[model samples]
Target: MVEERADAGLYGPDSVTWRIHGNQSMALAGFRALSLQAVHPLVMAGFNDNTVWFDDMWGRLQRTGDWVATVTYGTTAEAEKAGRVLRRIHAALPPGVEPESGLPYRVDDPELLRWVHVTETESFLSTYRRCGGILRPGEGDQYVDEMRASAELVGLERHTVPASEADIEDYYAYVRPQLRVSQVARRNTLKFMLPPMPRWVRLGTPARPAWAGMVGLGLAMLPPWARRLYGLPGLPTTDLLATANGYAVRRVLSTVPLVITSNPAYGRALRRTRGPVAA
Candidate 1:
C-alpha cells in the first residue's frame, strides 16, 4: 500500500485526466488543463489527490452537496454552449482506428457521436442540477428540445431520419462497442488485480447473510421498518468522513511501490550517445 501510494504520487501528473474541454473563447480550457496538472504536485506535497482530474472535480462537487452534479444540467443556455463546444471538438477528432475485424469508427459515426453527446451533456447537466440548476420552470419542453437538438448537432441521427427506431438502433450499435470497451476494461481490471488490493479498498458494506441471497423473498419477509433500518446503515451521509478518508487512503495505496524505470525516450537518447563528449 505504501509503495502504491508513492508510485501514484510520482506518476500523478502524467495520469490525471481532468482536462477542460478545449474552446478558444473560454479561458477555462487552459486553466482546467493546468489545474489537472497541478493535482500531482499537490499529491506529492501530501494533500489528498484524486486518481483522475474529472474524478477530482466530481469529488469536489459531491463534497459541496451536489452528489448528482455529474449528470444534471441547470440552465438551457449553458447546456447549449457546452453542447456546441463538444460538437466542434468531436468534429476535430481523427477518425478512429479500425479493429482487427476491420470495422472502424469515424468521429462522426452516429453511435460514437451520440454517446459522446449523451455523456458530456449528462455530465455537465448533472453537476449543474446538483448545484441547484434545473430545466426552466415552465420551459421543460424547451430544455428537452434543446438537448435533442444538441444531440443532432453532433451528427447523431436515427437511421438518416429525424426520429425512428432504426436510427436509434443504428446509433446504439455504433456506440455500444465503446461502452463495452469501457465497462469491460473497468470490470476486468478491478477483478484481475483484486487479490492484491488491501482490506480497506471500500467494499462498501457487508450485507447480512440473509440479504445476500434471494433478494425478493428476503426483502418481502422483512418488515418495512426493518428494511429501512437496514438501508440506513448504508446511507452515504452517516459514514461520510470515514468513507472519504478511506477512499483517499486506498487511492494512495493502489498506486504505490515506486518502481521507477528510465523513460523509454531516455533509452533512445542513450543509443545516440557517442562516447561522452565535453560535459
Candidate 2:
C-alpha cells in the first residue's frame, strides 16, 4: 500500500474535490473522502453489464447531455455535512468538463477514475464487514467462500485462513506494485477507511436491474466448497484499522437525524397550469 501513492499527482481529483468542498477541516475532509469514495462506485457499477445501480446520475447525463448533478454525500446528517464538501467539488468544475459533458464523466477523466477505483475497494470491504455478510445477496457464508475462490484463482494462498500482519505486508508488496498505484497516492488515499452508512441504507425498494440478477445467479450457482476454497488473500489484523475507521463513520452517521425535503412552491404553480385531469 505504501508504494501506491508514490506520485504527488495521484490525488489531483481528491484534492480538487476537497478544495472545492472547502474540506479544510480534517473531520470534513475525512468524511468527504469517504462519501465520494462510496458515491464513485454506486454510479459506475450501474453502467457495467453485471451491476444494478449503473451510474444513474451519469446515465441521465448521457441521455440529456445536460448538467443535472445530484449531490448525495452522506446517508446521515453528519455525513450530509461532509457531503457538502463533495458538492462543492462537483460544482467547482471548469467549462467543457461539466458533469453533463458527453464523455463518460466518471470513467473518462483520470482523476475521477482513480477515485472510483479507490472507492470500489474501500466500500466493498467496508460494507462486507458492517453487514456481517447479510447485506449482500446470497447466504452469509457464501460471501467468504466466493472471496476465497477468487483469491485461489489468483494463485494466492493467504486467504486460506486468517492472515498475519507480515502476510498482509507481503501481499501488499506483491500486489500493490503490480497495480502500478503510485506510493504517494496509496499513502494519502489508503490512510483512512470510508465507513458504511450507519442505518439500513434503503432506497425505497427499487427494482433490481437485469444484469444484477445475472451476477447474482452466477454467484449462487457456484458450489459452496468451491467458493470457500477461493482465497481473498489478506491478513485480518492489517485490516483492523481500516475496518474500524469505516464503522466509525457509520456510527457517526447513525447519530444524525434523517433529513426530509419537499418540492418547491413553483412545482404547485406548474401543476395548476398543466391541469390534473387523469390519474
Which candidate has the highest lDDT of all? 1
Error of 1 at 40 (Å): 34
The parts of candidate 2 lying over 4 Å away from their true place are 1-125, 128-133, 139-177, 180-234, 260-278
Distance from true position, residue 258, model 1, in Å?
A: 42
lDDT (Cα, tens digit) per residue for candidate 1, span 117-188: 443333333222222233445332233333454455445653343233234345445543332222222232
Give the runs in model 1 whose Cα sits over 4 Å from its true position: 1-72, 115-147, 153-279
Q: Mind sharing the TM-score for model 1? A: 0.29
Report the C-alpha lDDT of model 2 over 1-279, residue by residue, as the tens digit: 132321221112222221221111222222332333322322323223222222353353232211101111111232334335444544454323212223343323434433333332233333434423223342223322333322322223524421332332343344332222223222322322211222433233322232233222222222232122222123444245444544554455446553312212223323433453334
